[model samples]
Target: MKRVALVGMPNTGKSTLFNRLTGGTARVANWPGLTVELASSRILLGANMVQVFDLPGIYDLTGGAEDEQVAQRFLSEAKLDAVLLILNACQLERQLALALQLKALGAPLLIALNMVDEAKRAGITVDVAALSEALNAPVQLISAKYGQGMAECKALLTGIFSNESHQIDFSNIPSASTLHQTEKQLFQRSVHQPPILNQSATDKLDRFVLHPWLGFPLFVLMMLALFQLTYTLGTPLQDYLEAGLTWFKDGLLVPATANLPQFWQGLIVSGLFDGVTTVLTFAPIIFLFFCLMAVIEDSGYFARAAFMMDGLMSRLGLDGRGFVMLMMGFGCNVPAIMGTRVIRDHKARLLTMLTIPFSLCSARLQIFLFLSGALFSPTQAPWVVLSLYLASILIAMLTALLFKSKFKSSEPFALELPPYRLPLLSHIWRRGWGEARDFLRLATTMIVLGVVLVWLLTNYPTQQHSYAELISNLLAPVLSPIGIESTLSIALIFGFVAKEVVLGALSVITGHEGQALATQLAHTLDPVSAYSFMLFSLIYIPCVSAIAAIKKESKSNLYTAFSMAWSLGLAWMVSFIFYQSARLFGF
Candidate 1:
């Protein structure tokens, strides 16, 4: 298949165009540097299937940033039949400089004047024919978001394969500053625009949302509301799903397998069904969390939050984009770790990856929500959950500070805030389903394995001197200081597979579900120990998937081992302090 690469400056809607062309959810955020890795998908154009690669956004091909290097390497390494140089019409003069740079790369180029609708709305008009003549390239006006001019763009791309590739002389290519000045002259010659004093709705809203004093407070409030909605609206749905799963197990699976061997029946019903059902019950919360995050992300508020938080992040030798990736961590650590690619700095990216494990991901949050409702008062539940989230943020910040002196800082941080638009329901659904689907895919395999292992440990050997007991006894001396006993320690062990499995593991051990399980937990754990356990869970080594992501991103076993050792040590120390301090106070 022929290859076509989508190349453009950051925040020019290039990813959105890629999604439209390839029908893949490559994570379209209204912020710069979201596409840190190369994303490729094949699409049938006319009679031929062509592979379209979405390269990481870069300001200059000649620059030395990580993303720029990736793009340059991809162009040099990959077989490319054509390059689609997308540009933001609203920022034509600035975007054109990158386009000019790409033109000098001597590849067959097509200019996609994206965001033409936004430019028009801003009272700017571009003379496409004149601009095309000047650039000596085919300029296609497109709005990737609304699906306008896509067919024409694809048709043009299809025709490119038949034509000879365009080649330009690199020797005559102008310098960056010279190209910028030339782009300005070209823009002035071919485009007419209104005066710069006019304020759009985005500017008006940013007056408050971006205000130094008000922005951070509003960001906190928005995040609080997100959690509040996740609980309030998701609880009933979660209950319904849990009940449905239980009914399926008792109503269908039990009777269907009644004649099977007793051991087989126990493995099928008590082990697999219960464990899988328990994790699935939390799907509602995960879905809800993603939906809310998608809304915040699509509405462009996430970028503003990053901009607002840049000062605090810079103090820790990070930047606003790292903080944005941290916020993404609250939904899931896997993607958040992947999202760290947006951080152009190698040290900052690694630091951000290290901090994400402390972000109270949805799986950990699910466990906390379950425990909070089961053990604490109604009014206290919200506060308990909120406190854990706050603790996660505090620990992540502290972790950054602790390591700030060790790593040198990278490039200066700059973020472009896209205009806020109402999030489409389809976009929200796509993002929500995407995350939920990924969670299920990971959870199904890991949870089942974890459950089967725990079940084998507890059920085999006639339940006397069970493996859980043996392991707990072995670790008791070490765990006792943190107020964690055998049962809890065993659950924590399985939690390494996935955090959601911890609750299910406990339920399996006690032969209880729902309220019965809650009652059993209450008898086993005091408030202080419970809180200490929560704290430990919040800071412990990440799940297997997260560890793999860290290793893949950092490409260092030592760093990955360090992450585990540090988190485990931190968890133990923090939990021990909490437990011992509370006991000393006679709580």
Candidate 2:
């Protein structure tokens, strides 16, 4: 059996190539650090089988950043026989440097010229014969998206077993010969052309987008366009999914249970399916959103966006690299936290992870859409979304400032405006399915338990009164300061597990326990109160999964408790100020 490792920079499509080679695609994007863990699989060549490992894609071999350093040690120390130095043929010069360093480790190397189709489409040619002659080993042209050179890529590695014939033995690693001229030529021969751009197309874009003169306005335009696209294209469908999920639960599930015993029916219809599926009913919107983001990423526009944010990112004591993680936070924070392994600075990484939950995720956007759609005018709904996103950035930056970490951003990073290739339908499906499946699995587990527990709390009556009423009455005074009534507090309690539950719980209680709380709030409060309530809802408490993630990542229950407490406090303070300030301004 043969062993192979895929190596490249972040966003260099190593995972994409891994999928093509091993028939295993774990979600890919233009975003960096998606593959933080090393994934393994088996590949077959004729009758022979090969074990393959897909380690995290890193920009350099230098031991820095958590994941990159971890990967570096893996390559240098692990008992590996061969490695395929995957290169973004379109951006070879930058990728070639890493290839050089990998070759320095004395492994039997096959240079896989990945994204060849992309490079050719971009009017660039990689003279592979010249490349192989210069590199001292086999070089193959491949397009993972199209599976063009995969067979030859596999064929090139068949001679690795015999030391006398191959002259590439494991004992050569770390020997003085490791840095000899033959190794240097192997590194140099692996590439034909330099990076695609001289000035770096990203620098040109960054000069404008990160410009002190125009950056903010351009940033606003980009964000506004993204939000508008999501809501404009997404709102009708978001509403549709909600309606369909409701119809399934209410029109079908509810009435079917009308014949069953009252308790049994509530447990089945409302508690199990309604509670869980209703929260997950927005899967289509989440799926569509992941698709939109996937297209942006695959088309290579996202890297430019990250480059543009470097100036502001640097202000927050992080490099342009950290911007990618923050952008992923808009999708979800868990992956964003995991992605921080790309950052070499531990303090900066922790701060970036801590601040991501503050970013407005798509889950919370549904709440914004519902409120602004119901309460505010249609055109203004977008402003609410826009403001929340802007507020998140503002909050993230302000909080990052409090930590006051000092860092220099002088890395020799180059950008490539490679030709935009058509996103493969299979690639899109593979990426989207991985996330959607994980989400469904999660919905069935944690959120199902949450809804069932809420049902019990509402159904089980205490000696004095109903437990639901007791819960509502108890939280009434606490939420009263922000003008949120007992019903909303009850909704927030369910939301302690996940934000998606707040609306679902509200929909369920519209007729019963929520009635008194709703009436009292409506009579006493105004729109300002609603705004404060929405703001509070957005920032309060890390969800059950988020807390669990914090504990896992930070390795401290105390840290998780502290994070929950501070965010909860911040939510209250922010909501309190906004409500009182709105009143003082005579709104």
Candidate 3:
């Protein structure tokens, strides 16, 4: 099969085009020997199947940014038939430099001017024939969003395979001046923009969203609403899922396993089913959260939020990019740590990676929401969750500040804020469904295993004094000071493997699931100890995946060891203080 790559600068509608062309049948594949993952899919174009890879968005081919380096390396390594260079038509003049760079590398390039509809709205015009002649390549005007000019674009891609291709040589990057001049000449000859462009909706919204004083506060409100909305909407669905799972267990699983020995039945029902299903109920909440987050990100407000927070971030020894990675950490710390590669400075990258684990990932969010809802009023539950988010940011900032002097970053930060547009339904569904699938996958696999282990430990050697009690009693002295009880200590021990298993392990050990488990937990602890447990979970060791990511990205066992030690020590101190302080205040 012929191979082609879709390459473009950030927010050039490149991924949109890739999805449109490949019908969203893409899978993420790690490029050989590279930490970055690219989306690749096989699509039938003109009776021939071709592998189309969507490369990470980059500003320049030879830039020092991690994404740029990945793009450069992939192009150099992959034997490709052609490169589909997608450029934003509205930003044609500025983007022409990349086109010229690719051209100079002797790459077989088929240029697609995407977002032409948006360009036309801005009163910008591009002469396709003139641009093609100037660049000596096939240039097609396309609006990948609405499927405009797709046929012509696909035809151009198909035609490219007819011509023989040469290896992309990146060693001969043109001088900046020459590339700039050629880009200018090409833009002048083929593109036209209105003398006075009207102010866009994005600009109008930014007046308030990006206001100096109101921006951060507004961001806080947005976050508050986001969490509140997630709970308000997702709680019902979670309840329904829990009910359905309970029905399945009582109605089907119990009957199916009735004939089995008592031990086997207990292992399958009480251990496996109870533990796994408890965690699985959070799948709806996780999906809903990611969907809302996708809306914020796709609307272009996330970039503006990063811009608004850059000053404070700089003081904390990070830039807006680090802030973005920290927000990404809310989804999962592993990828967020991997995302630190975008930071060019080694110290800053390491710092960002170290700080990301503090962000409250969805896995921990499950524990917080379950506990807060079980312990607090509905009106207060959202606030309790929001407070944890605040704690996450505060902790991350403090970590950065503590390590700033040791690992300083002077690399200048620059970011692009794309125009605010309504997010596509397809995109939203993909984000939500993908996250839900991942959540379920984790629950059924690792969480199930962890729960079974918890069940075994709790059920073995005699019902009067199980192995779990023995182990928890052994660690009781250390955990007791921090307000964590023996049973919770068992969950924390398995939590080191994966935070998703915490609730499952608790359910298995407590002999309850879902709301019943929450009720049981209410009997075992009060608000003070509950909050203390949440804090400890928030600040303590990350899951095995995140630890592996830190080790791989930082490439230092000592640094990885330090990260674990720092988080463990900090988690204990913070939790102990909060728990003790609350008790003193008569909470």
Candidate 4:
């Protein structure tokens, strides 16, 4: 198959165009270097099925960042048929420098002037015909976000592949200075633009969102609002889903299974149905979080948040990009670990990965929500959740600081600030569904397996001296000091498989669900112990999938083991302190 590589400077809509061309959602965030790895998809062009590779965004081929290196290696090592060079039309002069350099490599090239709509709206005009003539390559004005001019771009690719004209002479690539000069001259002659009469909306919004004094507070408020909205809006939907699942299990599943063996009935009702239902009930909160995150990300606020946080991050020998990845960790630590690829410095990437496990992922948050609502008053529930989030942030920062001296930071903080726009409903839905899909795909199996294991352990051998009881008895002494009961400790073991299973495991063990389960929990654990348990869940070793992601990204078993050990030690110490301190305070 013909392999075409999509190359561009960071945040030039290359990933968006790749999605449009290949019909794939490759995580189209508004920031640069998000495409840290090569993403390839097979697409039908005319009668030929071609493979399109989306390489990491690069500022220049000569740069030495990890992303830059990945792109460099792919270009030099791969047998590519053509190079599709994408450029942000609004930043044409600066973006064209890389385009010119790619052209001088002599590959059959096509230039995609992406975000042309935004460019024209900003009063910039490009003479596409003249620019194409000067570059000696095809140029297409495209708005990848709205799918404009894609058909023409596809046709151009088809022509290029059919003609076999993509062969490049790498012997005489131009120097960086020469490419810069050529790009300047080309743009001066072929592009026209007028000065803006007023500041852009992005500027106006950034004045407040990125203000020196207000930025941090606004960021805090935004995060709090996100959690508030997620819980306030999602709870009813969660209740509905839980009610429906209960109806299915009772009104249908239980009746149908009455004729079966007792063990089979228990397995179906108590094991599979209960476990799956518990997970599915939390889907609303996960979906809402993704939707809101997509909105903030699409509106270009995350980059501003990054800009505002760079100073604090720098103090820890990291940068704003790592902080963004930490924020992403709230949804899931696995992707956040993978997202460390955006950090150009090796040390910063490692540090970011190590700390992300402390980010209070959605699974852990779900448990916290359930516990807080079950144990505390309605007014105190949100604050309890917020405290855990704050602790996660503090722990991550502290962990980074402790490890900062081991590795020298390589790249200084730098990021492009995209213009602010109202997030499109379609885009938001796609992003939300994408995240939900990934969560289901990655976690469902582990959750179901863990549930089955818990059920088997608790139900087998008449439940008097089952495996769960044995394990709980063994761990009782170790857990007593931290105010964690044996049963909760057992559930935490299952939680290591996937945090979503913690509540379900507890329910299975206690033979209860909903408010009944909550009542049972309240009877077993006091207020201080409950809060301590939440803290432990917030900082413990990440779920199994996240460990695998860390191993894959870091390619170091030692480092991965270190991460697990570090988180485990920290969780234990924090929980111990909280529990002991609360008791000492006479609470």
The number of the candidate with the highest lDDT is 3
- Candidate 3 lDDT at 284 equals 90
lDDT of 4: 0.84
- Report the Cα lDDT for candidate 3: 0.87
* Whole-model lDDT values for every prediction: 0.83, 0.68, 0.87, 0.84
Each candidate structure's TM-score, on Cα atoms with residue i matched to residue i, is 0.94, 0.84, 0.96, 0.95
Least accurate 10 contiguous residues by lDDT in model 1: 162-171
Error of 4 at 488 (Å): 1.4
Q: In model 4, where do residues sit more than 4 Å from their true spots?
A: 163-172, 442-444
Count: clashes, candidate 2:
3
lDDT of 3 by residue, 1-587 (tens): 88999998877877778889988733211111112458888989988889999887777876787767888899998989999999989888789998888888888899999988889889999898898988889999998878999999999989888555557887788744568878888899999999889998878999999999999889889999998999999999999999999999999999999999999999999999999998988989988998888788778777787788899999999988888888878888987898787778999999998899999998999999899999999999988998999999999999999999989889998877778877777777888898889888888789888998998899889767999889888989888988999778889989999999999999998899999999998999898899999999999999999999999989999999999999999999999899888888988
What's model 2's lDDT at 377? 66
> What lDDT tens digits, residue by residue, belong to model 4 across residues 1-587?
78899999888888888888888888777766677888999998888888999999888777777778888888877777788999988898787877787777877788899998898788899999999998889999999999999999999977776445354544576656767778889889988888553578877888999899999889878877887888789889888887887788779999999999988888878877776666667777788888998888887888888888889988887888877888778778887888787776777788889889999887887799889978988777877888888899899999988899986686768888888867778778888888778667645687777778889999767689888888889999988889998877778998898898898788788877766678888898888999999999999888999999999988999999999999999999999999999999998
* TM-score sort, best first: 3, 4, 1, 2
Better of 1 and 3 by TM-score: 3
Q: For residues 321-350, what per-residue lDDT tens digits would candidate 2 score against the true structure?
A: 666776777777777777777776556666
